[model samples]
Target: MSALAGVALEHPVMNAAGTCKSVEEVDSFARSAVAAIVVGSITRQPRTGNTGNVYWPGRVYSINALGLPNRGLAYYGEHLPGMVERAHEAGKPLIVSVAGFDVGEYQEIAEVVADAGVDLVELNLACPNVWDGGAQKRIACFDPGQTAAICTAVGDALLARAGGDQAGRVPYGVKISPFSDPAALAELAAVLAELAGRPGGPRFVTAVNTFPNALVVDADHRPVVDVELAGMSGPALKPVGLGQVRQLRRLLPDTVDIVGVGGVGEGRDVAEYLRAGAAAVQAATAFWNRGEDPSVFGSILASWIDAGGIDPVDSAIR
Candidate 1:
């Protein structure tokens, strides 16, 4: 068994946000051997998402500019209780992934989801496809101040709901951008480290959201994605994501958990993330491309860990 942020997980694998968009998809994951399921990132209102060839799959990696299309928060609020119950029955935690255009929106969504009795909430700060007022907005994770503000707001919101106590409070984490720049990464890590030092602050941080703004072209040399750029995932991202997890693991105190994401396709990939100091790992493209039951991958990972084929360092922060 593995544990994240004080919660025990039957395994260390879970689905990434946006991979499971519908209630049916969430149910499919619950029935699988995945240790947990993170629902698609939900916005304040429903979005139809960007138009034109939004997804392109290749041999090495895949490109997507989905623009966070999802049903609004109200839809999830009404449906999540049942999903949470089903996940509990399957011995898994149902983590709600939330996104917003601004700080208040993030806090509001966090408060609502926390009250819904979901096991965890992930604040999505690194969706590169997000467009506001017909323009691409800056990724939240790139701004350490804004990122910390949002985390503080969400944490305070959850704590307020618990009558200013930490017990029985809902835990929350942030989904960070893939930092290709070491300086930017250290700045963000500093912000997270400070939050981790506070009472009722973020309990965990998920590293390496899909690398943003990849340009893929057609045979005619024209851009393939309608947005001209999209987030890239799959094998190409493993090195960058793994590096980010290693960096964050070294920066944050052991009290904070790290969830590694990006480019994970097999048991060894999961083991690699664990060795990098991730308490758990998440993925989407591998499951999407294979078009098979997610449990198949989870079972492979479980067997690898059980047979002692791979050894993960103790999850405690070193």
Candidate 2:
């Protein structure tokens, strides 16, 4: 079995957060090949999300500016117990994506989800569409200091579970933006490295959210999607994602897992991330393009198996 952050996955293939938000989607994951079920990047209040055509999947890649649309943390926290049970019943873990607006929000989310018994928390530090009063905000992953503070706050919340200590704190992971500079990655890694072995520290790092500020136009010479620019993903992003994974695998402590995302549409893509040092991988564009069908995961897994399969990453050459 493949594992991430000490949680066993039926395999390394799972859906990216935005792709698995609804209750029906949760059920679909339980019936599919995904290693785990990830619920939100939910906020304190429900968000209507960006309107208009905020998404476009092309021949090689897809672009989206869907915003951080969700039913909010309360909805997620209220239903988390059932979700966790469903995932566990299916022999997988349930990881919630925490999209807090601030460090305090992260703590609040941790308290709620942790109390509800989620297996893992994914701290979303790099969503390009996070807006404040309709104005887009900066992504936190780019600021090392902010990243540390948020992580510490979440850790503190988890600490409450362990009686003022690190032990028993729920392990969390950071979903960060793709970096164009090695310096940026190294900076973030340094922060995460400090928390690598400590309880309540991040135990996994999701290599990318999406390449930000990417624009695509249709034949009319106009922006294809309603948004001026959006986060890009799909086959074209594999190189960037793989490079990030390779760099992260080198930068992070081996004990921390690396989840590779971007441009994964098939099993070969999944294998590519594994070869690039990702312990597991997430597929978003492919799943979306296939209409969010859970079977897409099964097909991806089957394709991976057909490609002669990969030996466990712990034994394979990376």
Candidate 3:
């Protein structure tokens, strides 16, 4: 079993938050082999976000400005308990993803979810769409100080709100922006390494959240969504994801765990990520297009694991 941020997972494959639904969305997933299931991003207040068809097209990619639409805290709180129970019954780790505009919003949402008994919390510190109200502009999140501030705030909040062994038991981590510059990525990793030395700090990071913007317009040539840019995620993003894993591995301390999520479509993709530095890997878009095939990419990974081709404990930076 692989453990990240104190959550012990039976496998290394996890569904990215917002991409995968609760056990309620795909009934078959309840009994599937996915190590963890990250629920939708929950916010302190409900947000309708930008409406209409927000998904944009690409030759081998797609851009979206969904505005991080969510069911808000109250409803999520009411429904999440049942979701968590169902996931637990099916023997899967439950991770709650939290997002917000600023420190207060992020902290409040995380505290509420932690109280709901999630095994871990994924903080979205670098959501392109949410960063500037659909400006869709691409900005780097490679600044270690900026990255550390956002993560530390959420981490401290989680630790404070969930005091006791229970508090320490639920570890916190952040997701990074996909288009991070090499220097920025190194700086961010350095910051995370520094924070790891603090009394209570984040346990891991899900590097390279999504690929840089690849805006696609509708047939009318008008923007699909109001946002001019959108985050890219799919098979095309795998290489960038691997680069992030390697970069972070080199800069971060050994204690810091990494969960790679970007564009993993096959077992080899997972293997590449693991060899790079990820303790675990998450594939969103590929599985999203595969429909009900829970084993779409997982079967490949299983064979690799069986063959010992993928090592979850390998932390090599390059």
Which is the leading candidate under TM-score? 2
The collision pairs in model 2 are 234-263
The alpha-carbon root-mean-square deviation between model 3 and the true structure, to one decimal in Å, is 4.1
**Candidate 2 per-residue lDDT over residues 1-318, each given as its tens digit:** 678988766678888888877677788899988878788877888987888999998999899898889888878878888888888888888888888888998889878988888888899999987668767889999999999999988887788776876657777889999999899899899999997766677889997898998989888889987877899988888899999999999999988899999987787888889989998998889988998788888888778877856444442322
Q: What is the lDDT of residue 218 in candidate 2?
A: 81
The clash count of every prediction, one per candidate, is 0, 1, 0
TM-score of each: 0.94, 0.94, 0.85
What lDDT tens digits, residue by residue, belong to model 3 across residues 1-318? 667876777668877776654446524566666788787677777767666766654556656666677778887777777777888888887888888766677777887787788788888776667645535433325556566667677677766765634335467887888644677566677777888877557788887776655676678888776766677887677788888888888888887899998777667777778889999988667665665466764675565565565455662221
lDDT of 3 at 198: 77
Which candidate do you rate higher for lDDT, 2 or 3? 2
lDDT of 1 by residue, 219-271 (tens): 99988888899999988999999999999999889988999988887778887
Total colliding residue pairs, candidate 3: 0
